[model samples]
Target: MLNSFDQKKQKILQEIQSDDLDLSPKGTIDELCIPIINLINSNDDMVTTSSCSGRVSVYLEGTKSNRAVVSKGNHGRWLFVTHEPHDLKDWTSKINFVYTSSFPDPNARLILYKFEPLILHVKCRNLETANKLYQVAMNNGFRESGIGSNFNVAIRISIKLDIPIGYKSPKDEEFEEDILNLFVTKDYIKYIDQLSLERFEENSKKLNQLYKAIEKDLSNGTVLTIKTNKPNWESKEERRRRMVKEGLKRQEELRELKQDQIQ
Candidate 1:
């Protein structure tokens, strides 16, 4: 689905952060900070020109009206913090008050965004074969997006599956569980969030080779196997049991409601 331009971008992006760069602390620094610092330091060639490499003066700005702590200074750019005034501690508190006069209240709703790593260790025949497998994954809906500075791609499929369905019921607990399950589907977990693709792909290629060795033992009588991890195997099995239990509970509730209506 990605165009040639996207592919070019992917390559360019990869150039910015190779495997070695990813392993470095400086490489994983906040993206917003990089640009601000770049503007102040980098020249026409986009190389840093800063003579000294120690601490720099960061200016934090506060809101005009309510004066709540909303944003803080990153390398040079302002970053919005989600947590409220009371929740902040130590250096974060000082930074919070310095940035915004209006601090977020205790009741203020916040959505915390974080990066989760998915590591896959895959074994395969040769380098050429491994490259082909990576190509196949790209063809699927897998995006080239990475988590933090890590080159490993983040699977969007899990986030996509967390949609609410059907009418609302009084059973809040059941509804919450259903919503949670939808978010952690195997397709999302296998490809997107938890498993490391590069490592797993190699492992999977090896698995395919192993499966081929004993095709007779396989249920489908085939040796070929895709490198999708089985993170949801146990969870899925538990889901089946939960479904039966919820069905029974719902039926009983429905029966009671019907009886009340009849009486």
Candidate 2:
């Protein structure tokens, strides 16, 4: 007979495999983070509750008041979003609508772009397991990781971007095209998008490192060998940079193997 913890683990893993319980808009696992998620789930004591590989997005914020507390929810709020790094042209196409469109929400105050890094939430069989997993993750590029008494471990990485793309005055009925254009010009938009893509590369490296560490230290070697790549989603420049990085990594691994053989 299985103990309570094992039963709980089995139930959660079953739900994950079923695909019917998913309430998320995307309704699927992130492609890049799948290796790590699979590795973590292979552990007898852990099950992942959520994970995001990363994202780049443009958002429309409701009006802010000095006296009121900041609150957030997304529905009509996201003007643009992507799980992968995007071409500058993808964002530029939306620039015309910023001032020209008849928006439903007159309370909209700002348009901002952001790149959020990888996040993972896991439920452990016990507090000890959670702490052990948290330590392994924290040491391997997820320095912002946290654990709780509830036996949940959260892997929170730090590579990120949050920049203002455009904004308008609260007193104005509509923002002037010239004023908004100064802030979100084609050149400026491209600059910010490129910068966010750079951050996403760094995020991918950290996530890969964290996954390797977890697989080695916690997964008991039962994790499947999953190839995590989405070549179609990458921009030309982004692909070149990632390839260069991979080449350097291969060279480093070869050098280490030579050292081991010498020993």
C-alpha positional error of residue 75 in candidate 2 after TM-score superposition, expressed in Å: 6.9
lDDT by residue (109-193, candidate 1, tens digit) is 2212122222222222234434433343334423442232212222211112111111111124753311111212334323422
- Backbone clashes in each candidate structure, one number apiece? 24, 0
The number of the candidate with the highest TM-score is 2
Q: How far does residue 239 in candidate 2 sit from its true spot (Å)? A: 23
What lDDT does candidate 1 reach at residue 21?
A: 27
Candidate 2 whole-model C-alpha lDDT, 0 to 1: 0.66
Q: Per-residue error at 130 for model 2, in Å?
A: 1.2
